[model samples]
Target chain A: MITDRIAVDIKVPNQTRYLCLIGHIGENIARTLRNYSGDREKLAYDLNLVLTEAMANAIQHANEGDPDKEVHIEISIISQRLIIRVFDFGEGFDFKQYVRPGHPLDEHGRGIYLMHSIMDEISYQQTESGHVLKMIKDL
Target chain B: MNLQIEDKGAAVLMAVQEERLDAHNSGELKNHMLKLFEEGKNNLVVDLQAVRFVDSSGLGALVSGFKNASSRNGNLKLSGLQLQVKSMFELTRLHRVFEIYTDSDEALASFQQ
Candidate 1:
């Protein structure tokens, strides 16, 4: 029989002010998982950077800075992998339709791309309530 | 984020005095840069030595500043990027967009040559 492995779960109001809090949480998670992964500093830095992009999208785009909305985050460790999920309760965009900003001067579109570059795997799923962004890193 | 501005003969150097640049304060940096452009100072050097971390929003602020400076025939260059901050720039492919230097002196000197 296989059992689910749950690590950390948190929900915060959809406010840009909470971004730093998310960063701290991500750093802590990375540090905790470093014991398993044996890459403390790099993993912590990567997670910190990825969380900023993910939470920014949720706070700015998905929830549209609506204070009443909530952003859910879940972290799990399983099978030598660390998984993170960010859930937003708002209309979600199609990730497959995304295109890298053609021009180097483009300012606003690099968040998702940055997320993909650092994480081992990334995918998106639309939930009944809103959407879920799943990211995995090898431990 | 706090910014310290210094007038160095050829270019104005704006040093980011914060340790982290994120959504909470990126807008402040953007607005400050735009304000400098409005004041008729064009050649800009942003010193990021103290900024250890930057997210997409922070990068966006810098891009906006670059565009604003370019619109007025001015230039915006970057210097003193920490390892993680430099990695963020490369990951976003923004390294192609801005001229980055290892130190503020080199970045400031580029404006002359």
Candidate 2:
């Protein structure tokens, strides 16, 4: 039994070039946690699903809605709780406006739906700096 | 992603190769599938054996395929889900929404009904 602890924080510019940051965030946060469920496959999938959704969401809904502004992502995990905050450096999004389930035949606007469903709790705070979405998942 | 449609017996099978079927390619894939179904070819099966990663975007593509096929009086099934991709299916519980088989051949044979 090993109780090695770890932590990582990354900053990424909101350029489309940084799209792969989702994969990185998943790897970092998953590594940071010490105590986790023994099911390797389940743990991998759960972490991937949550991180990918959150990262993609941040990329899509950046603060100022600026295509070039950088989005800030800070993630930290302590024991069983994984906390992730994705900040967008663009204009704010109309959270209430895009919450609909959308048309059945469409393939977009489904990110938030999946994210909210998978994470234990997901909340968003929009400030003058940008939009910050914080998510927590209990392992 | 490379998408190929196969007409096997009574089923129309679609093979998706590459990484994503989301915002960038979902529209195109939907258009292609819809066009085929419109041509009276139903009974769709998606072969995802080559796909390693899929996100919400990918899920949306599968869902769109499902709705379109069902709406047209046909059905859609998925086969050959890799470990990582299969996790997405189970995580979303969309696995329950979809008919998954161990392989593409089984998925095709299932359309005999």
Candidate 3:
């Protein structure tokens, strides 16, 4: 069993094409956790889903699909919890105003909802460079 | 955006050939489904047996297709969802919105009924 914190930082161009690569990285990281007692496959899938959604929000919504911009992602495991932070250069939205769409037919709002549902904690904050969306999950 | 499209007389079956459906190719899917609607083939069955992962963008594309089909007085159904993909639908409560089947055949038959 590993007790020390493990972390990785990645910076990718703000393009949708990189979402798959980041998602796979997150999945592989979850699969390698030595102390987690829950289902590894399920945890891996959830991590992949949250990371992909977070990156999509940054690339599409925050960065507005600007290929020139870049998104920063940091994943760390500490104290039996997984932490993920995604940073973008665009203006952040009002997290408090976010509401799950009442209609299931609405197509554009599920990304934030999915991240919140899968992660144990989620927050968006402004940084000196830009904005960062932080998410955590208990292992 | 690899899809195996088969016209089944009553409805069209579009089997996604990709393992993961995310932001990368979901736009292509949305455009293809929109084109099918424009071509007067509004009833569709999307088989996801080959897809193991789907993110919110992929779900959005399917929702967009469903809305377009509904607006045209047609329908869009789904079939062969893997476990993780199925869980995503349930999490977003989209499973209640779209008619799902165990296989493409069943989804096609639903169009007949």
Candidate 4:
């Protein structure tokens, strides 16, 4: 029997103190795959940077600055792909479609645009649970 | 996050040595930058040669700091960004937002009229 699937789930209390946990997640998972195969290190680095940015956006903006809400993350490594799902119990914005040209004069509204630029596939959906962002990349 | 400031008459350089600038340290950086403005130190240069990554919140903090400086007759600049950290600006198109230089010396020299 070959085991090729892994999942990491966490429920953040929607506070700044908990934000640091997000930065370590992708790296930790990637570290665990040292002997597995493929460019696990690069995948982990990418996941770490992109996921932290996405989660930071959720914690800061999507919740309307609410710190009592719930933030959930689901990270799974299956076959040659890594899947990341970040959801929040707050109003969501349409970020995947936002585009700001490489202008050196604008400062805000670039998080989602960058996320899509880095992720291989990104999507969003609204549910009773609030707004969910699903992102996938091949490692 | 740690900051060291140097005032050069026409420009003030802020050297930042932080690994991650997400929500964890974004607020602190914001407060510090604001304090610089309070002291009338306006020519701001953020040294990110050590920061490997930055998130939206971190970027937001930088943006907020720049606005504050701009409102006070000063400017904010960036220096020594790694490829990873530099990409944040490219991805978000924020490379257009800051006066980015390769280092503090370069950024300081540019203040010449």
Q: Which numbered prediction scores highest in TM-score against the true structure?
A: 3
Candidate 1 lDDT by residue in tens digits, A79-126: 667788999988777675443444667777777877887888998888
Docking class of 4: acceptable
Model 2: docking quality category: acceptable
Q: What is the TM-score of chain B alone in each candidate?
A: 0.96, 0.91, 0.99, 0.93
Name the best candidate (by DockQ): 3
Q: What is candidate 4's lDDT per residue for B21-106, written digit by digit as tens?
A: 87678889999888888887877888888887787778888888888888888788899998777877776667887889998789
Pairs of colliding residues, candidate 1:
none
In candidate 3, what are the lDDT values of residues A2-110, reduced to their tens digit?
5748899999999988888999998998888778778889988998898999998898878888899999999998898889999999976766554354468878788
Which 10-residue window in model 3 chain B sums to the lowest lDDT? Answer: B55-64
- Interface DockQ of candidate 1: 0.71
Candidate 1 chain A weakest ten by summed lDDT = A94-103
Order of models, best lDDT first: 3, 1, 4, 2
Candidate 2's error at B93, in angstroms?
4.3
lDDT assessment of candidate 2: 0.70
- Name model 3 segments beyond 4 Å from true: A99-102
* TM-score for each model: 0.91, 0.76, 0.97, 0.82
Model 3: CAPRI class: high
Candidate 4, lDDT over the whole model: 0.77
